[model samples]
Structures are given as structure tokens and as C-alpha cells.
Target: MSGPAIEVDDLHKRYGDLQAVAGVSFTVERGEFFGILGPNGAGKTTTLEMVEGLREPDSGSVRLLGESPWPRNPRLLPRMGVQLQASAFFEKLSAREQLQTFGALYGVPARRVDEMLELVGLSDKASTREDRLSGGQRQRLSIACSLVHDPELVFFDEPTAALDPQARRNLWDVLREVQARGTTVVYTTHYLDEAEILCDRVAIMDAGTVLALDTPAALVRGLQADTRVALPAGLLSASDARALPGVGRVQDGDGELVMSTQEPARLVQALAERDRLDGVSVRTATLEDVFLHLTGREYRA
Candidate 1:
């Protein structure tokens, strides 16, 4: 309790010739919402699995709640909950039944099942069979099952993958509620925006290594990536935009024109004078920009 909720030191994993996690290390503070972010095959899941005691690391150490996880420690499992990337459920089982079953395994009270269902917004569909629930509803049930025992630490791997925008937003609220109740959450997702808004701190992983770990704002600020200017496409030629003072990079983002500039005020004034400020908007670098800068690739692919 005095130390970090989770501590990983020089963790490594290998699958034959493939090295999944390579000497990764980080700490999650007590009750903090920590996120692991990366593109596909970045070893985020492998690292999380090692820390969760679900898989053995090739070398190094992991301490969850201040105890070793690799040796299959009994004390660690009950105090920690996990929602894997994919969960299996009996097609015929009701959502409530599924939670009740998991609760019984954890020796948790049946009342806890109802509480979890309500917490994850599944009470209305509590009686719906697993096969009958929508993707979002099923995902909520998966989350409810993980929290049925009220573990001190929870690990979620891509909890919002494949969800629609609205469902994803709703799940974000559920995760916020979970954190509000004082549960330390270790989450992994490909969604950089989700990581930006949800995580207290994030570790960006790639090629079996942790590229950077820090608060979202700190990471973006570290880049010193200039302010972003957005406006309708074709407002200015790429060459002319680059010719502007303090402008660093000009990108055609979809149909909108985006440019990075250090002197936002000057850029705004210039655009206004040129009648190019009709739909212009100025903002700071986002987590997505930072991720792209660090990895030299898009977060999605």
C-alpha cells in the first residue's frame, strides 16, 4: 500500500525467435488510471499479461500490489481482476447469470453482482442471454464480470475495440466510474484519444520496448510540437503555408488543411488578413501527434 500499486522491472517475453516484450519497466501508482498504448503487435498485451500473472515472462520481474506475479502467487490473483482482449461466455447464459457465476468463483456476495451490473449499465439487459446482447452490451458484461469481486487493481486490454463511437463514449464513462470508486486500472488500447482522456499516465510501447512514459500533456509538451492550425482545405498552397513565420509542417488531413506553427497568434493574424480564417481553428498538439512523432507511424496503422 505504501509503494506503487504495480511495479514492472526489466520484463521480457519471447516466442521462439520473436521477442514480444523487451526489457520493459514502469510503475502504476495506487488508484491511478494507467494506460498502455501502441499500434498492433507492440507487446502491450504481452507485457500486461506478464504483470497480471496470466503469462510467464522470459526474464525480469513483475510485482502487482507489491507481490510477485510470475510464480503464480495465490494472494495476487484474488486482489486483482482482469478483462482480457476477448472473453468467452456461454451463449445461453443470461448476463446476470454470468456475473453470478464469476462472483461465486470469487466467493463474492450475490449483491455485488447486481451492483456491478448497474455500474456498467447492464441492469436493463441483465436478463438478456450472452448471445442476445449487442457488442457493446456484451463488452459491458465482460467489464462487470471483471469487477464482481471488487479487486484493488483491474487490467483491461483494448476494452473498447470494435465499438461504435457512441458505445465507445459510453464505455469511457463506465471506466471513469470504475476509477472514481478507487480501483486502480491498468488499461491498454490502440485509441490514442482514449488514452489521452482516460489515463492519468500512459506508456507508449513499440517493437517490444517502451518508447516513452509520462502524463499525456507532459509527453506532448516534451515534443515542443507547435500549435496546430486547422481550416478548410485549399485555403493556402502548401508552399505558401510553409513560407509563413514559425510554421513547421503542413499536412493535408483528409479534406481539411492542418499546419503546425510555433507562433499561433501570428499565424492567426496572417490567416485573418488573407481572408483564410473563415473556419480556422488553432490548438496545441494532441496525443495522436505525439505518438506519430515518436513512432513515425499512425496510431491506427
Candidate 2:
């Protein structure tokens, strides 16, 4: 396989006495949509900032497309785009003007501005001032500004933090378009559902370290030891269900019998034999489950 488009090796960052990112390591292959997830103060922002060259790591290293991410290499700055957690634009500047100004900074042609506006579905708002646009529109504009120079890799920091459902979906589509164009993306978000839907692979970080890193499916399946099987209320009693093959625990709840097992197929078949399975629901597990198991905290907590 080719070397990763973005690579971090034992990255460490600090703020005075506090260790913000501690020996975290991961890689994003070229053209892949990678996600980083964590709660507040989990060092996610610090890690991303280091990779984006907005901040320096106290130790270890980060490379973007095979070069150091820090020291702001002039030749490399144009090949990368970034959407900060809090985007600030000149309030009086029109969307078109903002894009043109940013384009000039990267020596990008003015035509690229129109292309970016269209790419983010903001072409109709080109004449709108930054302060006059709605939150969602401004967010779209921020994304468009990042791509004005057509960077090969883009870093998105909580890109959908405050958007409505439709706006968020629009952003997702835009990101999909970016990926289809073969741009590698490093996305950090608090939304696990967004990560599940958008990322090819994800790294779950907390307390300055990665707790798990894998494709969403694989990560969820890794929690199979606690598989949950939900069947209709009258289907089976807790005691009878526990005696089934591979079922280690069973609980009655909310008009269903919840069974936990490492081998769901065996338990499922056992339950099926007695005509005790109805409205059966089997889930492979999820990032939320992994997060809960690993940190002893809920995914949203």
C-alpha cells in the first residue's frame, strides 16, 4: 500500500502542566475520509490543530502528504485547506469577495471562487455579506473559502456543529463530492452518527489518547461479546432465554427480551427452535457501544 496521505507518529502536545495530546498515533490513506471523535477537552482539537500546522506538537511528529505539518511551509500551505471550529470572516465582505481574497492569498485564479461557491451550493448567495448570511449559509461559505484554492487534503473541525438537519445533510453531500474528487479529508466531530455515515475509518480519542481505531463496522463488531438480541415481549422468558445456546445473559425490558451474547447466531437459532423469536432485532453493535465499554461513559457524555 502507498504511504499514508496524513501520518502522525506518537504525537504529543502540552499546555503548560497539562498534557493535551499524549502519544497519539494514526494515519489517513490517500483519498480516504477519516474521522476523529471525542468529547470536549479530549485533545481532539489540539491534535487536529497540530496536524493542520496551526499549532506545534511538543514531541513526536505529523506529516501531511509526506512533509512536516508545522513551520507553515509556503509551498505546502496552498495544497491544504482548513475549516476551523470557529470561522471568522470580514463581516462586511460579500461571499464572493471573501473567496476572492482567500484565493489571492493562495495565488488561486479568480474563477476558482465561482467553482467553489457552486461546489458548496452557495453560488446564489455570492453577493450576501458575511454578517447577513444565515448560520448555515455562513458555514457553507466557510467551507467554500477553504476549497477556493482546490487543496488536495482538507481538514474539517466540527463542520456540522450547529447546522440544521437539512443543512447538515447538504454539507455531507458536499463532503461526499470532495471525496469523489479524490481529496483526502481529516474530519473531527462530536457526532458519532456523522462519523459512522461519512468516514471510511475512524479513530476514537479521549483523555489525549486513542481508545480505538478502525472502520465503523469493525469497531462495532469488536464489541460482539455483548451482542444484544431483541425479541417480542411474549416470545421468551428470561430464564428460558438464558438457557439457549451462547446466551450468557437475558433481561426483560420494554416489551422485549434483551439477550446478550458473544455468539448471536447460536442464540438466535436456539430461540427460533422454540418459536420464541418474534420481532427479532439483531445489531452488530456500534461506536456508541464501544465508547461506553472503553471509557465507562456514555457516547454523548
Candidate 3:
């Protein structure tokens, strides 16, 4: 395979005595939609800022498309697009005017502004002042401004935060369209399901440390041995269920029993032989389960 589009080696950052990012390292391949997932204050934003050349790391290094991120290289700036967690704009500027200003900075043609507005579903709002737009509409405009330069790579930080479900879905579709065009994306969000659906691979981070890195399917498979199988009532007690073939653990709850095992198929067949199984349901491991198993806590907490 070709070298990574983005690479970091033992990346570290500090805020006074606090070590915000501690030796985190990962690589994002070209055209890959990579996600960085973590709870609040997990150093996710700090890490991304360092990668985007907005902040200097206290130690370690970052390489963006084989070039150093520091010193804010002018040539590299136009090739990258960034949408911060919190964005600001001239409140008096209309959407079209704002896009025009940024377009001039990148030396892009004025026509590109209208194209991006349409791409992000903000064309109708082009004449609206930034302050008059709703939060979701402003976010869409921010995304549109980021793409006015037609960058090859984009960094989206919590792009769906604070939006209603419908608006969030709209943004998700827009992002899908961006990816379909072969532009690489590095996304950071608290939404695990979004990451699962949109990202080709992800790196789970906490307290500046990388807990896991892999495709969502591969990460979930690592917990396959802890798979759960739920069986219906009057079937088996906890102890008897544990004694069943391939059953590693079993817990009875009223009319239902949840059995955890490395070999669910064997347990199912064994239970079937005794006529003790009814309405059985097997749940394969999921990304959320892997996050909880590895971190011993909920993701949003």
C-alpha cells in the first residue's frame, strides 16, 4: 500500500502541567474516511488542531501528506479544509459575501462560492446574514465556506453537534457526497453510530491515549467471545444454562436468560436438543460493546 496521507509519531501536547495528548500515533491512508472518537476533554480537538497546524505539539511530530504541519506552509494551506468545533464569521456578512471573502483568500474563482452553497444545501440562504440564520443553517454555511477552495482533504470537528435529527441527516448525506468524490476526510465526533456508518476505520482515544485502532467490524470481532444469546421463559435457570455446551456464562432475569459464550452456535444447538430453547436471540458484538469493554465505561460519559 502507499504511504499514509497523514502520519503522526508519538504525538504529544501539554497545557501547563496537564498532558493533554500523550504519545498518540496513527496513520490515515489516502482517500480513507478516518474517525477520531472520544468523550469530551479527551484531547481529540487538541490532537486535531496539532495535525491541522493550528497548534504546536510540545513533543513528537505530525506529517500531513508527507509535509510538516508546522510553520503554516502557504502552499499546503489551500489543499486542506478545516471546520472547527466552534466557528465564527462576520455577523453582518451575507452567506454569499462570506463565501466570496474566503474565496478571495484562496484565489479561487467566484463561481466556486455558489457551487459550494448548493452542494451544502445553503443556496437558498445565500442572501441571509450570518447572524439571522439558525444554528444548523450557519453550520451548513460554515461547511460550504470550508469547501469553497475545493480542497483535497477536509477536517470536520463535531459537524453534527446541536443539530436536529433531520438537519443532522442532511449533513450526513452531504458528507457522504464529499467522500464519494474521493476527497479524504478526518472526522471527529461523539456519535459512534455516525462513525460506524461513515468511517472506513477509526481510532478510539481517551486522555490523550489511543485505546484501539481498526475497522469497526474488526474491533467488534475482537469481542466475539463475549457474544450474548437471549432465550425465552421457563427454559433454563442460570446454573443449568451455564452447564450447557459452549456456554461460558449465564444470567437469568425473570422470563429471559442472557447467556454469554465464545461459541453461540454450539450453545444454540445444545439447547435445541433438550427442547429448552424458545424464541432465542443472538446478538453479535458491536462497536459500542467494544468501546465499553475496552474502556470500562460508556462512550458519552
Candidate 4:
């Protein structure tokens, strides 16, 4: 409460000969929205589990809410909530009943059940059975279950892993509202763009190690990447775009001529002066660029 909400130092975990998490360290400030990003098998979930006290680490230490999380500390359980990647529930239980069941575990007040339903946008589907809910709706229910007892710190493991685009965006609003209410949110996700917009700071991990850790803006800025200027394909050929001022690299993109430049404003000014501004679009470096830069574009398991 007085210091950081969560602090991890040199965390390590191994199964057989494979190292799942190697030397991971980071801190989550009170009321901060933190993100852990990595490819599949990058140990994001394992690191989160160790921090949540659900799994024992092979080395290093974790201080969660000013107390050790190992050995399954019961005192900390009530203050923190964890949503696993695979949500679990009774198929026949309605959304309301599912939440009530979780609230019962913490001896929460009866009114809290309705509060969670509304909080996760499940009030209309309160009577819908768990099996009947859509993938996004069920994911929302899992989140509501995690927060039924009013946890101060919540951990989400890829809450929007497989949902449709619109649903993923909708869940982002709910996550933002949770942090707005002063709850510290620490979650792992493969969605780089989502983390770029939602997280206060992020840790990009690969091969069980943290490659970069910083705010989304900071990470992108540090990349020192180029800005992309695009124009209608027929407006200019790749050779002509290459000759334009401030153009460093030019390639023919799908239906457009893409030109990369460090001086975007200068390039735009040049284009404007040339009366070639039609259908012009500018693309700046993004967190996805930083992520792909850190973890190469190669396929990952």
C-alpha cells in the first residue's frame, strides 16, 4: 500500500531441461496498468503464476502487496484476483450464479454480485447459462468472477487472446474502468497493439527473458524507427517516390507506394508543395514495431 503493489526480482522457473522464465524482474506501481508481452512459450503465464503465489519459482523472489507470495499465503488471496487463460465454470450455472459462487468464496456481501454483473456488462445476461455465453461474454464473466470480492490487484493472462476485434476492444474498456477505480492491473498478452494503448509500462519477453521494459511510448521512441508515407499506387511509381525529398526507402505496398523517411513533416511539406498530397497517409513507428524488433518476425510456438 505504501510502496509498489508488486515487485519481482530475478525470477526463474524451469521444467525438465527447458527454462520457462529466466531472470525476470519488474515492478507494478499502485493503480498502474502493467502489461507482460511475449510470444507463445515465452513464460509470461509462468511468471504471472509465480507472482500470484499459484506456482513456486525455482529461484528469485516476489513481493506482492508487501508480502511474500510463495507457500500460498492465504492473507494475500483476498486482496488479489487472478484470471487464468482457460476460464472455468459449471456449464449449467447462469452468469449471476457463477459470480455469486465466486463471491461466496470470499464471504462477500450479496449486493456485490449484482455490482460485478453490471461492471462487466453482464447485467442483461445475468440469467444466461455459462455454456450459452459467447466467447467474449464468458471471458467477461471470468473477469467479473476474479473481481467479485473487490480485489486491489488483479492479474489477467491474455484476457483477449482469441476474441473478435470488436469484442477485444470492448473488453479493453472494462479493463480501463477497473484501473480507473484504483485497482492495480497486471496482465499478460500477445496483442501488442492492445498493450500499446492500454498499459502504463510493458515488459517484452522472449526465450524466458525480458528483452525490453518501458512505457509503450518510450519503447517506440527508443526504436528510432522511420515514418512511412504512402500515396495512391498510380500517383507515383516506386522509382519516382524513391527520388522524393527525405525518402530513405521506398517500396510498392498493397495498392499504395510506401516510402519510409525520418523527417515526416518535411516529406509532407514537400509533397504539399508539389501538389501531390492526394491520398497521402503517414504511418509512424508503433509498439508493434518495437515488439517485432525485439522479438523477430519468425514464427514462434
Best by TM-score: 4
In the range 1-301, model 4's lDDT, one tens digit per residue, is: 4999999999999999999999999989999999998888888888988999989999999999999999999999999998977998976999999988899999999899999999899999999999999999999999999999999999998899789999999899999999999999998888888999999999999989999999999999999999999999888778877787889999896798889999899889988988889999899999999989988999985
Stretches of candidate 4 exceeding 4 Å from the true structure: 237-240
Winning model by lDDT: 4
User: Of 1 and 2, which scores higher on TM-score?
Assistant: 1
Tens-place lDDT per residue, model 1, 56-135, is 98899988888998778898878988897799986689999999998998898988988998999989898889999999
At residue 239, what lDDT does model 2 achieve? Answer: 81
Residues 38-83 of candidate 3: C-alpha lDDT, one tens digit per residue: 7776788899989999899889999988889897877779889998
In TM-score terms, candidate 1 sits at 0.89
Each candidate structure's TM-score, on Cα atoms with residue i matched to residue i, is 0.89, 0.87, 0.84, 0.96
Q: Which stretches of candidate 1 lie over 4 Å from their true place?
A: 233-259, 269-276, 298-301
Assess candidate 3 and give its TM-score to the true structure.
Answer: 0.84
Q: What's model 2's lDDT at 93? A: 95
- Pairs in clash, predicted candidate 3: none
Candidate 2 error regions (>4 Å)? 235-240, 243-246, 266-279, 298-301
| Ranking of all candidate structures by their lDDT, best first | 4, 1, 2, 3
Predicted structure 2: lDDT? 0.87
Q: Tens digits of per-residue lDDT for model 2 on 1-301?
A: 3678898999999888999999999999999999998777788888988888889888999888888978977767888899987999976899999999999987888789999999988889899889999888888899888888888899999889888998899889998999999889999887788889999999988899999999998988787657788888887778888788888778898788888888888987887787766689996677877766776674444
